[model samples]
Target: MDSISIDEILGITRGELLQGERDLKIKNVKIDSRKIQNGDLYIPIIGEKNNGHEYIEQAFLNGGSVSLTQEKDRPFPEKMTVILVESTLEAMKALASFNRHRYQLPVIAITGSSGKTTTKDLVASVLAQKYTTLKTEGNFNNEYGIPQTLFNLGPEHEMAVIEMGMDHLGDISKSIRSVDPDIGVITNIGLCHIERLKTQENIFLAKKEILQTLKNDGMALVNGDDGFLKKLKEEKNSYQVQTFGINDQQSIKALEYVSNSSGLQMLVEWEGKKENYSFGFPGVHNVYNCLVAIWLGHFYKMTQPEIQKGLDAFVPSGNRMNIFSIGKIKVINDAYNANPDAMKASLDVLETVGADYGRRIAVLGDMLEMGDFGPAAHYEIGEYARKKADVLIGVGDLGKEICRGYGQNRNDVYHVANADAAGACLRKIIASEDIVLIKASRGMGLEKVLDYIEGGNK
Candidate 1:
């Protein structure tokens, strides 16, 4: 990041100079003290378990030039610069907003219940064909992550793809106001974060917050297949609205598509022109993701060939549909996170991959933070998996609901208490050449089963 003077920081954050020189500039900003480098600005965050105010000394020892703190009376090392703020997080957000506006590049903010990361990666990959694009790394789509992403922007970056995630009504508004994106993309509105938002309608309202701070002439792209987003297309709006999906009514539609173990092939119809495209991932949901990237590419005046090359060059981020083999068995590690929609999509991939390789085995764990909807969601996934998977191994408490939905009469359906039990059960029942799909929410730790299988187990 470009260096910013302590004076500029104080003005942007409305913070007070607590100690040391005001003329010093910060070349980098860090929240974690352990990651502090020479000439970096350290901002202490107050989390539930641990307070970052305690790490200031360590940050200085690690070569931090400056620090921001909420503690007004705290002692500091001699010759250290400290800025005092009411809230370090709010100060950081202000600093990030300031940094974002300093660059004149077009920022594309993406938000939705699912596929946000994948869509971000795809959009960045396509834009990288002609521009030095910077995207949100991994699942850094929350409040802290969004600001950290913005702080990484430099003069070399020509475009930015920021992924915003929300669990409440105003989460997107907070991030999007800082971003002020030129284009806003919503992948789909689903039951993700239903525990906090309560209903799909509430979730849609939360997701639509991406447009709250959007530029007046900005473009809004949405999934037409989603009922909520489709309704959005009919609403009166200040900005331009366009839809992309496989359905015929979308502004940019995928007329035909085929999914297989190798990848997906699609014949898209855009602007009365028909063209074929391919991606190196196997999922129908990914087709929807590709359409967004295609629209962005065309918006920036990229040719069809360039757009296709960008799509072809795309790669899935870690733990999201990451495919690999263990001896004769194939594993699809979608263990990063799962909801009903994502689980169903992965099961569909398992069906397609297993069709060409071997038996479809689904090792699914509990989807956490589902509140009262947890049982029915898990059970519904199980019922869906019954048709897609040849053998179903359900892990965790809610996983039993999946087994129940798949039917207890079936000998192939098994319910284990956790990932450990699922690992042991898989060791006993898994056959050679079988394709396994491991999926669960972030809290489920289902990656342990993949670890167990990869740790010298056939």
Candidate 2:
């Protein structure tokens, strides 16, 4: 991998070395001033809440050796290293591209509406079995995050799994321009971010933008089961592509699957061989995530045992599909974020795991960004919840629609205003050994309900 001096960064960013050492070798790169360390290059960002430039002194206080700033007229400590740029974010993009191209490793670009993060985790887990892999974590799939992820790469990494996410057009385009992915995977196209893009077709078109940056003759894989994503099927489309799904006949598939709160067991066929495997978590939705991992394993020529070990040892990140025993109560905490498709899948898992006790409880919150689709989407999930769970609790304004749908089937529907009130209402009605599912959009912060009920993570 190529190492950069202050000279190279200035050249790439078109920045002027306003003050400080020309020979300074950047040992690390950080965007947050509070995390900047001695010998680290700090890029202060202009965010919605605070200007990073205002924290230049703080960065210096935290031992930041070099800094990138756009403020030209500001006074600074004597002889300190400062690179002046037109835009800190644009400069970060330029520097990231420079840093990325220096390493000749293959970059797998993973993108889709809902399960991108989980898919990224599975891909990393499998690939790391055979290679020193670097992957994106947390919210590190965006513009600033991608650049920071790139900067974290060192000479030890043998491969890169870069996750790209977008809300509008050109978001993934910009990230891919820097990543130059050798392989591309689209998990599935769904109704997420539709309010901004308006329609599913528009979302499909926006997702296609990831294809523009594919390496020459690069492999593209998508969910063959999705009505929208199945459009990527080659005879039916343009790019040469493979498919992965449970039901798609011409794709890699999982047959005869069984899942519970503890884990999932499935018979998956790949490359003319069939094997049964078990993973640490339960969700039919995760079968899709594993399908992507299986094909990626084949692409890298990993042994079946290697792939199975990787899948078997993997645990989901954060709150997505995480089931825990809190005292005498069971809590399914899928509260990281929510959309209609994700909500429905989580419900399916809840129904499966909670079937024994049969006291299945669902505490649902509003699915945001639906625009005009809000009412109808909520109604669809609400109607399904009525049939699936024994008792239903609805939170958020749109949740009233869920209550209405539940009221159609049963009388035990309770509607609450927000997470706090929902937490209070749930404590009053929740019983021992009753399986509880708590999920909502990030804005609802429904995880707090677990704190109210079981005091969380017992």
Candidate 3:
């Protein structure tokens, strides 16, 4: 963060100075006092468990130059910059909004039920060819995280490809009101967050909030192939909507796509021109991600080679379809997060990629947040697992339903209680010429199975 005058912060956050020099320079902004550097601006947050106002003293003691406090009359040490605000969270947002206004560049905000991170990465990768891009890292797509991501924006950045994630209504709106994106991309609406959202319709409406936040002249590239999103023209009457898909009437379309164990090839048609690109990543969902990336790349006027290079360079983050070798065995560690769509896609990749190795082992787990649809979702993935995995080991209570769904593999399919059990099962089932896939929801900690297998603990 660039140095902002204490007076400037007071002006932006509508905060009044309680003590200390108004001319003091704040070179960094941090929430945690332990992470605070000398002259850093500490913004205290009021979270569910503990209030941050109590930590203000500790922050200043540990080299904080400035602090925002919701407590009107907290005892403070003299000579430190202290600012009083209605709410520290709101103050943080206000400060972030002010910081974002400093940049007059393309801010592409991406939101979806899934694939937002991958979409953001691919978009940034493509945009890097023509622009110095700033992107959202990891779970930094929320109100608190997006602002921190934006705070890194300086004079050098030409474009900001932001990922705005939401599990509820108005989450995207809050981020959009902060960053105000130039372009918005909606990957798809699905059952990922349906537990909180109640229905797919609600999830669609929640995801659609990104479009509502778009500028009047801004472009929104939606998945026309998505059954829910394809109806956006009728559901919302706002801006001129652009569509992209594999099999539909749209501005950008994938003319042809093919995938093997190695990678993927696609013929994309957009703006009356056809182009061919090869992707190092596999899975049909990534083809959609590529289409979105290509659209964003083309919109920014990047050459076909640049866009292709970016796509080729795009690697899956988190534990999503990450294919690598584990000694003599090949492994796909997709143990990050899972809904039905992501789980099925990973299973398909497991089936395809392990073909050369001959043996396929899938250590599956529960797909949480399905609500009343949990059983059916697990069943759907389980039924698919029967065809995909030569050996299927299901974990968790929901895994029982998955094992039940894959009835054909009664002998091969075994249900375990947790990652340790799954790892033990995998140790016995996996061999030198085998390909193994480990996948589950974020809560399940399925990566521990991979750790166990890789660590030679089993």
Which has the greatest TM-score?
Answer: 1
- lDDT accuracy of residue 230 in candidate 3: 83
lDDT per residue for candidate 3 within 1-458, as digits (tens), equals 56789888988888988888887888867887788889889988878887888888889889997899989888877867899988888888888878888878888889887788888899899888888989988888888888888777877899998898887887877777888877778999889988888999999888888877566688778999999888876655556677888886887898898888877899999999999998887789888888998988888888999999898778777787788987888989998889898888888888878778968988899998899999999988888998888888899999998898888447888889998989888887777878899999989999888866686674
Error of 2 at 318 (Å): 1.4
lDDT of 2 by residue, 1-458 (tens): 34579988889999998998898788888899888887788898999998888888888888887889899888876657999999999999888888888887878889888888889999999999999999998889888899999988878898899888888877888777878777888887888898999998888877777777665467788888989877676444344687888884745888668887667888988767788777777788888888899888878889888998889767778887788887778889999888888888888888888976548999999999889999889988989897778888999999998888778456688889998888888888888899999988888898888878864522
Best by lDDT: 1
TM-score of 1: 0.98
Error of 2 at 118 (Å): 1.1
lDDT value for model 1: 0.90
At residue 8, candidate 3 shows an lDDT of 89
Runs of candidate 3 with Cα error greater than 4 angstroms are none
Model 1 scores worst on lDDT over the 10 consecutive residues at: 449-458
Q: What is the lDDT, from 0 to 100, of the residue 17 in candidate 1?
A: 89
TM-score of each: 0.98, 0.95, 0.97
C-alpha-based local distance difference test score of model 2: 0.84
Which candidate, 1 or 3, has the higher TM-score?
Answer: 1
Error of 2 at 29 (Å): 1.1
After superposition, candidate 2 runs with Cα above 4 Å error? 1-3, 235-239, 455-458
- A best-first ranking of the candidates according to their lDDT comes to 1, 3, 2
